[model samples]
Target: MSDAQTDPPRQRRERKQNADKRRRQVLDATYRSIVSNGLQRTTLATVAAEAGLSQGVAVFYFKSKKGLLSEALRDLYLIYEAHWQEAVEAAGDDPAAQLVALVKADFDPKICNPAILSVWFAFWGEQKFTPQYGEITREFDDNRQRAIQGICARMLPDDPEHAADVADWVDTLTDGYWQNLHLFPASYSNRRACNSTLRALAALMPEYRDQLTPAD
Candidate 1:
């Protein structure tokens, strides 16, 4: 056998790892392109250029522009999920505290960037025409709603219905923030939004109202 064919199995495994790493690098570059230029302008060649890889090498991993976009969206969701987990953990033991922490993290500059937000909105706009995008978007939205519902359940055990209601209400408020961030930056101040959301949820559950109130 030729020297290339004589390589050990471990060498083959290492090659696979390298390939996967390159694929991820390409995905990250594609994400940045989509964020900066929008999906319409993010061609495969553009992503390849961003990744500093040859176009043929990018095509080997992604196959098509759509495939690259799909992978990039999935990667973005995974990154956000990790951030969400960290925010939840930092909130400590109190469910009310957790709820407030989660809301604040949504608008925290460290956690939320214009590029990330722009990519999300772009994917959301394309969801209507793209079945894969639609499915992923629905899953993402449902997961977020479920997280809020779980937090509400913990905070308002006696009033389960109120828990769901409060969760939905908070979702509405956060969604509004996403819509008006550029138009009314001051209107969506993280601290004020968090307090207002907590207050609104508290009104729905008198049993937890005092617990959710900020300390003087």
Candidate 2:
């Protein structure tokens, strides 16, 4: 019958949608579990329970606890990448503007939070066991440094060597601030951290100092 024929296709479509939904659900649950329980205590059982899914289903989706946590890290990395990419585009062609935008993107409340920061630190700690990368490839950190270096070179055409050094400082400073957030969540404020970064950057890139550190 027509109803029977259409029902199978509808069910197939639904099955695909459900599969995607369940995968996302599990990853989100895994993130929450890691945030709440810490990587040491988080397990397949806990994530599955948080997701309201069976351990068997979690295993089928991700294959193992490692797989589950890997996917969660991947999700966070993509969000981080997209935020900065969009920030750069919005800042247009000015290297100084773009650099500032990219730096500020890290402190955006949407992605920068205690929960997410904790998850990042968790994967970092497990770097010995896992590949320790998400959507960001092994070269992403290098690429970002290169991008910042290039920007500084453009801004200060005379001192390319110092520009590269400044890029390294920026990269390390950014990482340190994020680690601070993870390490001292109670005392750290994203706004305060970002302001400190902006001040340091403004000092480092003096040509763009006033512009980078706008009044008020």
- Residue by residue across 1-216, what tens digits does model 2's lDDT show? 575466788797888899999998998998899888999799999999999999998999989876777777777777778788899889999988888888888889887888888888888777766664533445466666677888778877898888888888887878899998889888888888888888898998777898678454
Error of 1 at 54 (Å): 1.1
What lDDT does candidate 1 reach at residue 110? Answer: 59
RMSD of each: 3.3, 3.6
lDDT tens string, model 1, 1-216? 876578898997898899999988898898788877889999988898899999998889879988888888887787777777688888888887788777777777755555666777888889888889887767877888888899989887888987888888887977676656634666665566566766766676777778766552
Full-model lDDT for every candidate: 0.79, 0.82
Looking at model 2, which ten-residue stretch has the lowest summed lDDT? Answer: 132-141
TM-score, candidate 1, is: 0.82
Candidate with best TM-score = 2
Among residues 3 or more apart in sequence or in different chains, the pairs in candidate 2 whose N, CA or C atoms overlap within 3 Å are none
Off by more than 4 A, model 1: 1-13, 182-196, 202-216
